[model samples]
Target: MKMQRRSLRIEETLVKAFIYFSVICVVFALFNILWHILSHGVGLITWEFISSYPRDMGRAGGILPSIVGTACLVALAVAVAAPIGILTATYLAEYAGKSGVMRAVRFSIDTLAGVPSIVFGLFGFAFLVIFCGFRWSILSGGLTLAFMILPVIVRTSEEAIKSVPYEYRECSLALGATKWQTVARVVLPAAAPGIVTGIILGIGRSVGETAAIMLTAGSSLGLPTSIMDPVRSLSLHLYILVSEGVSFEMGYATASVLIILIFCVNLITNLLVRYMITKRMGAGAH
Candidate 1:
């Protein structure tokens, strides 16, 4: 009894130490990144700077165009990819594509997700921009990004659809409802939250992507007034700032914005998810 008690106590101490170490490590890294960004970006985050246009060496320049371009690109990618991704996910999970051709399609999607971003960029450049004659425009890049994020959204949404309570599906089936009716009415409602999560993740990935957009989308640092215009995204801006070393200050400013934007997006989604879960649980209880 004494030996067991001693062993339990030791184990408890080890677990506590492990937890503390892990938390401290994460905290340290977070603080380090924030500190670097704050020290550089705080002074540079003026409204004027945000509104102004870019100039040589970044000493007296702004990222107005870049910011706008990034937003438009992200929006375009999301709009194009969301519906396709959702449908693909629905088919994958609900239908599972029994036929040989459908199976091949599913296999291709799986493979696409695993493919490197650089290769996607290459394909986009060659096919979408050159041969297809879209040119190095925002439209092409946004489309490429949409294609790249499709696999992610589809896979995540498919899993979410699958995780819906089997009882809900079974009850719908028993009600003389067609598969489509059951899926649209019962399955979709239950899986809506999860599908949204996948879209959010796809957006997040799209916003952060650099290499793929770089090759496919012309990063002109100019405002994307139209879909055909060559534009720069925030990630593209970040890459540019880091690469040329023309201005470390701009790098810091851009990094800070990117971090803050990502945090806010994630936080809002988390709050929405929590509220949804709470509402669902309350409804279930009643």
Candidate 2:
């Protein structure tokens, strides 16, 4: 009996050690990549580099147009995906309970989540650019990205909504609140952080996307005047600089800017989530 106990203890220690080792490896890899990009790219960042346009095939000047285009694509994609995703999530979690239709819906979302981004690009190119006649523009790229990120939002939002305790819904209903009122006031408020997280994830994917944007939104360095106009995103610009052998210096600089942009977005959204949580807590206390 003592020997078996000792064996179990050794196994547990080994498991714990393995987990710690895995975490350290992941963290080290992340930091190493960040160091590499920041070391090379940080020096190239400047007001002129940020505010000016590419002069010689992205070898000289700034990435202002690419930055603007990336923002536009991410914003448009999130705006389109968030509402639809949230609503679908709400339906799946709150209303559709253990039905065949619900199962099918869940299956579809899962499948979509696993689909490659390049495949989405091809679909968008064929459907939106050709069939819908939107052509190669921000509109097509944004819509394509919306489709790509929709499943992520739906799955995350659904899980978040489900995580809200049923007791909260019951209490709201007991207090003479309707189903919609309970969901709107109690459930959604509780799930806001998770929903925001999903949206932020979608934004991150959209921002870093290159292939989809390349296929749907033509690589135009000029600043886009409208959604109908083709635009170049930072990821695509970086790809061009590297793939076409424009300039590694400019490529690294663009990569650094992209990283900074994503970091800022995540930071801002996290702050917003904290504010919402704080406000909710204060209101409850009052």
Candidate 3:
């Protein structure tokens, strides 16, 4: 008995040490990357650099067009994907039960989650760009990104909905509420944070994507005035700057901006999720 206890204690200590080491390694790597980006890029982050348009194939001038394009693409992708994903999740969670259709849906979602981003781009190119006549434009890019992120949103939302206590539904129904009423008023509000977290993740993916957006969106340098107009995203812009030897300094600057933008987005999403959770907790306490 004593020997077993001693072995268990040793195992516990080893596990804790391993976990701490992993955490330190992650933090160290993140800090190193951030430091390198800031040191190389901070000098180029002038107001003019951010506000001006490219002058010579991105060798000079700013990334205003890229910034605007990235924003528009992300917004459009979210608008297209969120409602469809949420509704699909709702049906799967609340109504599907243990049917064959439910199984098929879950399998399809799993397959989608594993599909490569480049494949999604190819599919989008073949279908939306070629067949549907959207062409190489913001609309094509947005729709492509929407399809890419749908699996993540649907799975996250379904899990969130499933996590809601059965008692909540029972009580709502016992109070003479309809099934739809219980879902909308009781379950959906509880799952909003998780659903929104998935949306934020999708937004991050949209912002960071390069090959997919480039294929569908066409890397035009000019500011896009309509969904039909092609545009260059920040990620694609950075890739071009570095790949074509346009301007290494500007490439680093664009990388820094992309990092900062993602960080800000994640921070804001985290705050929103925390606020939602806290509000829910406070309501429960009352």
Candidate 4:
């Protein structure tokens, strides 16, 4: 019995050591990449670089237009996607309940999620840009990104909603509340963190997309005055700089900015989520 116990202890120690080593490797990899980018690019980040337009195909000037375009694309995509995704998730979680229709819907969403971004780009170029008369503009690009991120939002939100305690629903219903009321007041609030997390993930993916944005949004360096106007994004700008051999320094600079932008977005969204959760908890306590 003692020998068996010793062996078990040894096995447990080995498993724990492996887990810690895996974690260390992941963290090291992330920091190593960050260090490489920041070390090479941080020196190039200037106010002028951030606030002005590119000159001579991104070799001499700033990336203000690309930054603006990226913001517009991401915002428009998330704005269109979030409500629709959430509603679909709510329906799937609350109403679908083992139906053939649900199975088909799930299959479709899974397929969409697995499809390549380039395919989405092509579809957007052919459909929205050509067929729907949107043209190569923010509207077309944003819509394409929306479609790409929709599955992620729906899946994440459905899981979040499902994770909410059934007892919470029961309690709300017991207190003379309707189904919708219970969902709105209890379930949604509880799932807000996860939903926001999914939205953040969508935003991250949208920001980093180059192929889809390039084909759909167009790579014009001009500032977009309206959604119909063609614009360039940071990722596309970086791609042009590197792929076309315009400037490696400029490309690295753009990469640094993109990384910083994503970090800021994630930080701000997480803070907001935390605040919402804290406020809800305080209300409950009161």
Candidate 5:
């Protein structure tokens, strides 16, 4: 009995030590990244810098045009990609055959998810922007970003649609509904929230992307007056600021704002999801 008790105590102690060490390591990594971002970016984030454009390139510079261009890039990318992605997902989940072609499409999507962003950048530069004569225009960057987000959107949307109860589809079919009608009325609506979540995830990646946008988007750092014109983005600007030996002041500030943007996007998504859940609950209550 004494030997058994001693072994049990040792096992408990070992488990506790492992948990404590693992937690400390994780916390240290997170806090270190946050601290570095704050330490570099805190000093230069003034109102003037936020509003102004990068003047020859320095610490006191503003990121107005970059911000505006980044917004447009994200908007254009999402708009172009979301519809097709959702539709493709709808088809795959509801209509597509389980044939070799369909299997191939699924495999391609998986491959796309794994492809390096830098390779996408190279491909975008070589094909979309340069070979196609788009010349680093918004259209090229947006389309490239759209492709970058496609796999994400398709997978997420498919999962969302799949999550809809089979009973709903069966009832619609039982009522003499056509396939399209059943999917349109019964499946899509139920999966809307999941689709939205997928869209948000795609948007998050597109907005934060540096490598894929670098070659395609270019680094003009001016407000985007038109899609035909070259544009800059916040991530691209941050990269430039870091590599060009510019001060950390603007760099840190940009990092901070990027964090804030991500935080706000996540928060908004959370609230929207909560609202959706509450609405469903209310309907159930009724």
Candidate 6:
């Protein structure tokens, strides 16, 4: 008995040590990358650098166009995907039966989530850009990104809705509420945090995506004034700067800005999610 207990203790200690080591490694790597980008890029972050248009093949000028494009792409992608994803998730979680069709749908969603981003880009180019006649514009890019992030949103939202307690549904029904009303008034509020998390993640993906945007949204140096206009995102700008050897300084600066932008987005999303969750919990308590 003592020997068994000693072995168990050793196993537990090893597991704890491994967990801590993994966390430390992740933190170290993140900070190291941040430090490198910031150190190289900090000097380039002048007001002019941020606000001016690119001149001399991106060796000079600011990244305002790229920044704006990124924002528009992310916004359009979320606007397109959120409602569809949420509705699909609700149907799968709350209405769908365990039939072969449902199983196929689940399988397709899982497969889509695992597919490469390049594949999505190509599909967008082939379908949205060429066949649908959207061409290389913000509309094409946004739709492509929307499709790319749909699987994530659907899966996350389904899980969130599924996680809602059965008692909530039961109580709502007991109160003579209709099924749809219970879902709208009780279940959805309870799952808002998870739904919001999925949306945030989808936005993050849209922000960083390069291939899909490049293929569907043709990289233009100038700012886009309409949905049908092509635009260049920050990620694409960084990619071009590095690949074309325009200016390592500019590349680093772009990288720094991209990182900071993503971080800010995540922070704001988390804050909003927390506020919503807290408010929901308080309401529940009352």
Clashing pairs in 4: none
lDDT of each: 0.85, 0.91, 0.91, 0.91, 0.86, 0.90
Better of 4 and 6 by TM-score: 6
Off by over 4 Å in 2: 1-21, 268-286
Prediction-by-prediction clash tally: 0, 0, 0, 0, 2, 0
Which residue pairs does candidate 6 place in steric collision?
A: none
Write model 5 residue lDDT over 41-80, tens digit each, in one string.
Answer: 7676788877887887645668998888888888989998
- The 10-residue segment of model 6 with minimum total lDDT is 275-284
Q: Comparing candidate 2 with candidate 6, which one achieves the higher lDDT? A: 2
Which stretch of 10 consecutive residues in model 1 shows the poorest summed lDDT?
275-284
| TM-scores of all predicted structures | 0.87, 0.88, 0.90, 0.87, 0.90, 0.88
Model 1 residue runs over 4 Å out of place are 1-20, 97-107
TM for candidate 2 is 0.88
lDDT of 3 by residue, 1-286 (tens): 9999999999999999999999999999999999999899988899999999998998889999999999989999999999999999999999998999999998998898888888988998999999999999999999999988899889888888987778899999999999999999999998888888888888887889887887899999999999999999999999999998999999999999999889987997889778867876786785
- How many clashes (backbone atoms < 3 Å, residues ≥3 apart in a chain or on different chains) does model 6 have? 0
Look at candidate 2 and tell me the lDDT of residue 278. Answer: 78
The alpha-carbon deviation from the true structure for residue 94 of candidate 3, after best TM-score superposition, in angstroms, is: 1.0
Please list the Cα RMSD from the true structure of every candidate, rounded to 1 decimal place: 2.9, 2.9, 2.6, 3.2, 2.3, 2.9
> What lDDT, from 0 to 1, does candidate 1 have?
0.85
Candidate 4 has an lDDT of 0.91
